[model samples]
Target: MYKLQLKPADKMPKYKQIVQSFIADIERGVLKDGAQLPTITELSGEYDLARDTVEKAYRELRERGFLTSVQGKGYYVQAHGDTKLKILLVFNKLSSYKKLIYYAFIEALGDQATVDLQIHHYNAHLFQEIIERSLGKYNYYVVMPHFTLATSQEEYLKVLELIPAEELVLLDKDIPELNRQVPGVFQDFNRDIGGALDALAKELERYPRMTMILPSDDNYPVEIDRGFRQFCRYNDKQVAVKDNATDEVLTPGTAYVVVRETDLVELVKKVRQTSYLLGREIGIITFNETPLKELLNMTVITTDFEQMGRTAAQLILEKKRIKVKNPFYTIRRGSL
Candidate 1:
């Protein structure tokens, strides 16, 4: 009586289940060295599973040295095998979420597994090149698709299609619409906005009116603006947003929120200039939390980009054990 059970509902394949069961028995000392194990056909019949499934289980056990098979003889138990794992964290920036994710990933993985991170900027053509260059350097990729959609490019989506779907764990963005068929760990903008708003509310006396300056043509920034506007509207605060391709809404209030500084630098600079011209101070907040934003005294509502990187690595390594289809995490830092 091996007492091993398999559940078909589990996401891991049936063969892997059978293989793990044998390994567990071996590790528990129930299956001793040189103990004659049932033949693949016999196990197949007993479990009412396909013969190929049973053979795959035995083959994996043999490959891992947990079992030995002689050409004409039945399988025999041997030893437990090492189950080391490896992961790769790929991101556009080495920001807070990225740093936090890196450290947390290393800590969570501990000494058993190794994690390697690659910093890739938001360049579609460069990403396409990197995809071809790093064909088999690691077991899995934790990708952050931070390419500026303003370029009307989906190179990352193409890269996703080129890579094995199961080998990727997308973070901070979604490519599901691309139909790449990969799993994801989303950075919940809605949840993040709620947290940022709560933090902003604490500074109610410091700022009077809040206005969002969104990128005229970016999905991520647009989503954040929508969430922020919804939050303000929910609280009965007047929602002031910059219309796409329109310069009519750049008027000063109290706060100016942006997604990407690169897209709206001129506008931000203009606002600052106008403020200086009028001798008034305006608070600013932007996404991605880059060093340029830090150089200024703008109140920031940002994600922990470093932690995001590290956690992306952790999630990819632990992906097999996750029960949820689309898991998300949001971390709040500073205020505006």
Candidate 2:
């Protein structure tokens, strides 16, 4: 029989102490593979614990794959302390900014957890399939739901219900339907964009006209467009919104706000083709920061992705269920 000393004053429950003792013994070689563990009644009587308490501990151990139950016999040790926390990380797509968040999460988690990342590519079907297949496999599920404009809130919430709310964390954008039910680390898109424009108020005066190149295909949050429009209207700044840059002409004293890197490249090529010098005659403000953007002298409005990842990891480690709005700022590099 295994002996465990339980403290009545201790915060941990008696059953948990027993479970930890078993694990410690297994890891220290005091308990070996196929070692028989005392029955629930025996353990309960020996430790002065309720039979249900001992049974609960044994159930948890078996569920965690540390022990196996033999029919009409007894429970035996199956494995030691080799269980690694498995996390399922689902993203819309693998972008540079997201890569920053991913690496930061890995660094924060260290070797105690393992992450399996998957991209749904903004497809609702794929997202559903991934979530359904990952229901019970992962101990934790971190999801970035970048649903399309056509995807309904019902569709998203339906699939999201597949995972237990306590074991899930929403990432990047927070949906209104879910409210504050689950913990999330999200960017306040509207406030961030509005704040960035406010920070660049003096610089924006150099350009008489401000144009934003927002792609219609990508499922960008509607808050971005709303924020941009509200800022321009409130400040009385002339603003034009474009879906693409194929036919748009670059003009002096005009600033271009680009969302996609491909559009930024197209705009830069057009500016280079023209006689207007970069940053001086044609101002550019791109969303999301990267090292290459710094080299290109592109001013950016971005959120602290690293900090978001760190906060998410902390929430998971501490088992906190709260919504957090990550920090955002404007990085001016002479582009605007």
Candidate 3:
């Protein structure tokens, strides 16, 4: 019999507890190879756990090849195998999509193949410090280079120079003049902005005179501008560009708003609150989704953060097997 234990007070999540217990049991050989285990329903009844908990744990074990299920039957233990490798997940400012990506990544890595993992949050000077310390601690370094206007690209490049590019994985943004050794799975905004524009164009037919209000800083808003311009050219629309709202030349048309993290939101709040700004029949769209998008009821082009994380992790693991660079890109989701 397997000792299915549950700790109510532990900070570790319940599903993870079930996973750790199952792995320990398998390694101890108490659960012999090809041994038939209890059905999820049976386990749930025995342990007083929800069925979802048991199912998730079993699915994890199956992904790692620790167990296999027979049709119309229960799961059985598979032969013990070598443990998984260690991989580090580094990011700045965790979001919903990013969390999703991390979960999916763990799923794809499989329990057997991934023995260890570390998550480091990059905040201000902490990002640089973590990168410097990570060189020797982790076998694989997956980085999300999310630079704000305050972060100097030169300073960032100095840190990038330290990691062997081959062992490093870049997620979301790109580092210019990067050495070839770094393998990057970057977020593709070109396609995303194009798609957002297409969606906006369809919306624009109802609301003419489209105006794009993009917040600017460190070329982040520029790529989105390129896409919006490309689509506008494709559809025969003219764009009036400006760095801030004070210079905004809003005519009778739908306004496409692009903003940077700096002062973009405040500008929008001013525009919304001020009767003069909101009086125009302007259709709005943002490059990155924000509270303003939801509050103002504007269209949004966003990156599938969780998917990006998962794919980056998968690419890193895949690189280990094939020794070939697995490409990275972004998924564009358009919404109101």
Against the true structure, what is each candidate's TM-score? 0.52, 0.77, 0.54
Backbone clash total for model 3 is 25
Model 2 clashing-pair count: 0
Candidate 2 lDDT tens digits, 136-225: 556689999888988888888888877778778999988768733999899988888999999998988888888999999988888899
Which residue ranges in model 1 land beyond 4 Å of their true spot? Answer: 1-84, 178-181, 198-208, 213-220, 232-253, 258-300, 304-310, 321-336
Report every candidate's CA lDDT.
Answer: 0.62, 0.85, 0.62
Give candidate 3's error at residue 256 in angstroms.
Answer: 2.7
Instruction: Give me the candidate number with maximum lDDT.
Output: 2
Which has the better lDDT: candidate 1, or candidate 2? 2
Kindly list the per-residue Cα lDDT of model 3 for residues 92-120, writing each as its tens digit.
Answer: 65655566667777777777344233344
Ranking by TM-score: 2, 3, 1
Ranking by lDDT: 2, 1, 3
Q: Which candidate should be chosen as best, given TM-score against the real structure?
A: 2
In model 3, state the lDDT of residue 21. Answer: 68
Q: Evaluate model 2: give its lDDT.
A: 0.85
lDDT of 3 at 77: 88
